[model samples]
Target: MMASFSGVLMGNSTAPRHWPAWTIYLRTMGLFCLLWYAMSWLTPNKILLPSPLDVASALRDRIDDGELVANATVSLTRLLVSVSIASLIAIPLGLAMGTSRLLEDLLEWPVELLRPIAGIAWIPLALFMFGIGNGLPIFIMIYTAFFPLLLGTAAGVRNVDRRLISAARTMGIPKGTLMRHVIFPAALPSIMTSARLAVAASWTAVVAAELVGAPSGLGYAIEYYRSMLDTPSVMAFIIVIGTLGFLCDAALRSLSAALMPWANAEEKR
Candidate 1:
């Protein structure tokens, strides 16, 4: 009889524990849905400020027309290519700067001066340099993402523990091996954070570049809708942009967290 009572009590306790998480999730979702509905219904004009439903309908139409996917793919491809180029250039430059004090001193002033300038500020120059093709926006995106990555990698390399370097040297590790195995691992989390920031910056730059002159992209779609006063379509594009940015951020964060589990543990500590 006592065993039966203990088992029943444990089962009841476990059941309540599972219920709380589900209950909280449901309540939060319900609140968001209610707010969304209220905002859509209460807004005055569909053209001026369309409801969520209107945006949904517009998005559906765009998707059905196959324009959204194609444009999105172009934008995404451009973003990826630009970021890849930036990473390749930035990482080597950062390493050189971190390893060589003289080089860092030489570049510091120029970087400090240039980094303050907005990425969009480069658009006119890029347009002039690359003309009105894919290169203009790609250049802007690369510029937007590059500085942060370089600075972050440099900082990370500089911050690597002296003790770790010493230990590697004591173990008869070659200088290259020490850098590859010790410094790189120690600096990786910081570099990952920088990369995440670069991705966001690149995403923003790409849209701005598209707005300036691209014939097709999410940015162009928004510009087109704005010109037409089609609030639903504009809102849809905004949602899509936000969604993509959020997804990129989330994915990078997940990857960073996985690569640097010590970061999470350190946070708790």
Candidate 2:
């Protein structure tokens, strides 16, 4: 038994490679479509779980009519703006807090207190404050994105080697130069990872924020269709949301690889 267990452990040491990404995606999605079709057929009410073909047809109609593009663009634009704002604030604040014990002490409590709260929980209050427009969704998404980015940056900064900083200082490097040339580069991978998380979190928040607060967006389209018992269209918008999020993450990964050539580009794998 011991020998067999040891052999199994040794055998598993090398990770098996998967097929090319496109093939993997198609295979997975094909299975998913088959499962969806089966469920749709089994369901008594077809409207509740529309067949894959029905959803595809609806999706095509939306695409042809340009509603899909308009709403997807709106949602994507909000995600970009909110994430940009969150990154601007969080990165600098995280760097400062991570480096300075005093500053970290001052801000740590507030961060801890608020980070536990879900972004969707703020929608009710925000809806009242922002009153049904772009501001509400943007505000919620920024809040959602902020904590992940801030935490990621601080962690990256903290993980940077003290040895490197000391070596740079011993060589008479300026404080600003040491930070720019040593700390930031070392922390770039972690920061990029956090940026992706921030983007995802904000994207999720935008949907919820828009459901109650905005006149336009993917969330609004989903809700509008749901109200009208248009499950196929709802599913279409959902598929669009998921595809956009995946594409956005892929773009970020490419950017990370380009920026940090020495690091493993597919670290998550």
Candidate 3:
């Protein structure tokens, strides 16, 4: 059964062959659209689950009115800014924590205490602290993304080949130079994986963060038309949110592939 699914997805070969990315995407999307249309036809409540054509029409209206562009731009910009800030702070702190036992011990209690708290749980307090605006969403997203980045960096650094570190130190390499050349490179793949996770986490959080706190964003727009029983537009915003998240992850994946060719080569092993 798995092979059959793989054959359809990957290629004609039951042995499971490689398929072009576009081919896989089209096949999956086509299947999804078919199922959706079938369900919508049978459901009798088009308002709740409209056909693909209806959703597409709603999407086109958004594009034509400039609402889609404006809201998507705001959400994506906030995503970038929040992830950047998270990486800048979390990655550095992660590196330090990974390297120093004492530092980790000192911060372990607080980090653990805060780490388990969901970002959405912070929304109520954030609303009170930052009010209904950019601050709330940005703060929520930052909190959402920070832990993954920090933990990934720390774990990546800790997992570095100790032999390599010893070899460098034995060669009389300075601490700064050794870290720049060896530790960072060795940890690059883990760090990149963490970055992808952080982006995803941030993206997920942004919707909820925007849904209640933000004045304008995809989430805000979804909630806006939803209040008026605008199901198609709500779904339209949902589709936009999904599509943008895919693009953002794709961009990050491309960046990881481009910047870390060695990681790719290693994975082929």
Candidate 4:
């Protein structure tokens, strides 16, 4: 087993072929493990701070029990589903509102009024309106992601170059074709950026929602650890959440880069 593990590590060429990235990753993992060990060994109190070893043990136990995987899967699923729904509506509505002065004026005040309200604050109202189970957290995630995406989309559409639009018209392009090809593509970078932000926000909102009464999720795990006074578990959960968020953001960024390579020029300019 030990030999196989070593071989696996050595074979991973995809992991930092260079010394710097490899060294940094190794050091980071080592530091985290060391701190965890020291906490477990030196910490006299379990309630205030469980040692790193204890948290690892708990994590292992939970994994064995199949709780961690289940929770994580549930939370991820809720996030994806809710964000999809929100994106479907938000992108189109935002485009319409952004491109049309009359629609923008009509929706602007209502969106502004609602935008000020925090996701957590809406828990009570959501619970009352949508009820519990998965609905509350799903709604919260959608709610958090929706506004940023909508605003970004609208702003992008509004900021489309008039010259390009005029040129498209001169070429006898239909309004729909112009919007589909010229306007949306032009504003894609901004829309993508907002979508990234919205995804991050959605994760935060989902965590908050899970905290309310979620049966299984990272948020539930944190709450469970807190209630049980397991500090290590709490810290572990925090690390997991942060790591997941970072990964999600990185993935979004990668996707944006892939879709809009020209956006890179905008950055250089």
lDDT of 1 by residue, 99-176 (tens): 789999999999999999989998887877887678888888999999999999999999998888888899999988
Whole-model lDDT values for every prediction: 0.87, 0.92, 0.92, 0.86
Candidate 2 regions off by >4 Å?
Answer: 1-21, 265-269
Q: Taking the tens digit of each residue's C-alpha lDDT, what string does model 2 give over 1-269?
A: 77667767787554354688999989999999999999999999988999999999999999999999999999999999999999999998988877888998998899999999999998889878889999999999999999989989989999999999889999999978887899889888889999999988888899988888899999999999999999999999999999999999999999998999888745555
Residue-wise C-alpha lDDT for candidate 4, range 65-147, written one tens digit per residue: 88777888898899889889999999999989888999999998999999988888989888788776888899888889999
Q: How many clashes show up in model 4?
A: 2
Candidate 1 overall Cα lDDT vs. reference? 0.87
Judge candidate 2 against the unseen true structure and give its global Cα lDDT, from 0 to 1: 0.92
Better of 1 and 2 by lDDT: 2
Of models 1 and 3, which has the larger TM-score? 3
Worst-scoring 10-residue span by lDDT in model 3: 9-18
Q: 164, model 1: CA deviation in Å? A: 0.9
Runs in model 1 lying further than 4 Å from the true structure: 1-43, 262-269
- Superposed Cα RMSD, model 2: 5.2
Clash list (residue pairs), candidate 2: none
